[model samples]
Target: MLRRSPHHRWTLVSRVMVGVLSLLALGGIVVAFAAFAYGRSAARQAFDPLLVGAAQDIAESISIGDEGPVIDLPVSAFGLLSLAPEDRIFYAIHGPDGALLTGYDGIPAALDTVQPRFRDWTLQDDAARFVTVSRLFSERAYAGRIYVTVGQTTRARRAMALDLTRRALFVTTFGGIALIVSALIIIRSAMRPLEVLTRDLAQRDPYDLTPMQADGPQEVRVLVGALNRFMGRLDRQVGAMKNLISDTAHQLRTPVAAIRAQAELALEDDAPRRLPRLERLVWRTRSLGRLLDQMLSRALVIHRIDNAAPTAIDLRDIALTVLDSRDHELLAPGKDVQLRIGEDAVVVLADEISLTEAVRNMLVNALRHGATPVVIGVSPTPTGSAIWVQDSGDGPPDAVRATLGQRFERSAASKGNSAGLGLSIVRAVAQAFGGEMTMATVQGGFRVSLTLPHHGAGQSQ
Candidate 1:
């Protein structure tokens, strides 16, 4: 035997149909109750007046006879009751002394008041309605009251009520069906947008990550906009991955070949000549290692820029953290490196790791290419926050400055000694955080600054 699934999934149309049908059923039940009540009230009102009129006619026909009272039943009274031919009727007359004068004797005489009254009763083992009226008499022979009672079986009233209910139910059933059909059409029309979106997504090329047109009802438009944003993020991540692979292959090949050749030469050289070849081999290996490390760092920085949530960071803290790492001392031993930051906090909204990597690259570039007495500092600019690395020498010549941030673009002064990715990393971080990198000749030295938009203290992005 096949097992049933634990979870049941319903389509939008199915849910809407179920909802519409449920509402209609509930409404039908309420309408049925109301129609039944209205029918009963109307039936009673229609027949009660006839019973009263017949009782009054019988009471008026009574007169004082020679002995006491005589009842002369009116033919018109019977004619009025004949309107409901399917019903059984009964009547009775009584003298002032409580004697049955004429007609059926079982209907009791009224003892409450001298007024006409109506009630429900059973006669001849069948349900019935009754009306009693008292007639006053003043004559020479008899001077008292005569009572008239009239009743009828309720068969016709019940039939009339049932007929009315049936007619109302007939109208309601057809009307409810029509309303359900119209609701289905409206629901299907409303769901068309989702159908179109599903088809568009299904037919799209896997590589196509462009934003979709967001045109529909407000809810559908919101869904489309969210889908577009998700695709955009995915596209950026894929592009970053592609760039990492290509940069790794293109930048590492020449150095890797050079390292292999130097290694082979060192192994073949005589002991007298082996020390210099070994030194060159070690230097080439270190340069290749540094190049690989910087390439990976650039890739990671790009990834984090898109994926990392930003927090409010004080620029002074970043500068202090870089100084505390002691990496600069290793990069350039015996070089003058100092920090110039005030006590006040200068904050920006950025990824901490990515920002630190950018700042570290700035210091590395200053140590490798610029003169001694290097300084790193943080300060508040009029428009934003600034973290800069300045050295005692004039910055790269104007011709080299234009191509400075491009990957692997070396200057003539470096003479093939630098990897050329430091400024590129700084530029990427600056642009990613809605900021800019500037190279300027300050009063003391050449300065490379990464200026970021100011974030309010304690605020996060």
Candidate 2:
């Protein structure tokens, strides 16, 4: 079974989506980090201001209140700490005499630094619950020095940290979800043009070699141009096939009619009395057979060229066979056809069957159309190998030499008698084998050479 043909396509939306989502995800992460940083800074700002005020209040009242060397505070002083959620708040103030002045009397005084104004530290309660804070107040707040320490339960701080984390996570997830959805939609829309091109190709008839009209992006335009080139080649091949059919049909009519007429004439017993007509009919049949064979060979050549047939064979053997096959036309004729070698045996990698056929065809043309002592030379060159056939008499007419490798081309004088595919076949064979056939004017006549790939193996003759 044959594999299905692909109409390749591409899309802009996929590229766009990839870029957009990548950038947005990155931006969202940065924003989340920035927000968390700001919140942490703001919490420190709020905590420090409140703690400093409480310390100042205790410092100012340290001179005396109801009792000696006491700092007085309202009944709602502890409620200031209770403003935060489900937290244990503790405060301590000690006079310069080293006696507790306010807040918890049983709580030991924390080791407070004199210089560090506000920092973070941890302390354990009687319940072994730890509270963390770092704060200090100087003697500038009152007449006597007072040590005041303030901290809240860690459970509340833990809850606040959890809340901030949840908010950051929510923003990241929401941003990611939004970006993903937007990316999918944009990608689809951008690629829709390619999908349209695909549908256009899918609806086409397989045999239709019509050019595409869809105008996509620039790279897509290049792809369309390539498709157009393929379509052009296909169109030319179809046209060639049509021309072949027409030519074959026209050529067949005469021979088929002549054979029918011959059979009809022979039906009468008096046919031998009409020997002239029978002889003419036999000659016509022979010419028709030769023409048909040439026509078939031409078709095969065209087919092989269009499909790129492999052509690797030994050229040395093909050269020998060609000389052997047409010995009578070459050596036995008054004209001599000879191969002069710079080397005895030059082997080549080529299509041997086609090469031999080309040689035989060239020699046949030389004998019938040119003079004696035609040289058929085989030699290897630095680049490739070559076969040169130079006839003694005047070479092919100017028109034949001019269109040497063209199909159905011939010299005007030889048009009626020659099939005109010999040189064409040679060229086609060369092309199929990834080589070239060329004609050049030599010292006395013209030379036809088929240059093919050399295998670099030979001996000096």
Best by TM-score: 1
User: Clash pairs of candidate 1?
Assistant: none
TM-score, each model? 0.80, 0.56
Displacement of the residue 229 alpha carbon in candidate 2, Å = 4.3
As a TM-score, model 2 comes out at 0.56
**lDDT of model 1 at position 166:** 83
Each candidate's root-mean-square deviation in Å? 4.4, 8.5
Alpha-carbon runs more than 4 Å astray in model 2: 1-84, 87-218, 269-279, 309-337, 340-364, 371-375, 378-386, 403-406, 412-417, 427-437, 451-461
Residue 10's lDDT in candidate 2: 26
Per-residue CA lDDT of candidate 1, range 106-173, in tens?
77557454878887887788999988889888887888888888998889898888888888989999
Worst 10 residues of 2 by lDDT: 126-135
* Tens digits of lDDT, candidate 2, 1-461: 96654422323565566677788778777877776676666555555555555555555544544344455664454555556757666676665556765666554454454532553444453221212122232434334446665555545444555577678778778878887897788678666767877888899998889899748777667877888877876786786688679878887787789888886776673846668767767877877776777777766656545555444455556666877787646434666767665545666655555577787767766766667677778877666777777787666666657786676676766634566777887887777666788887778776788887765444222
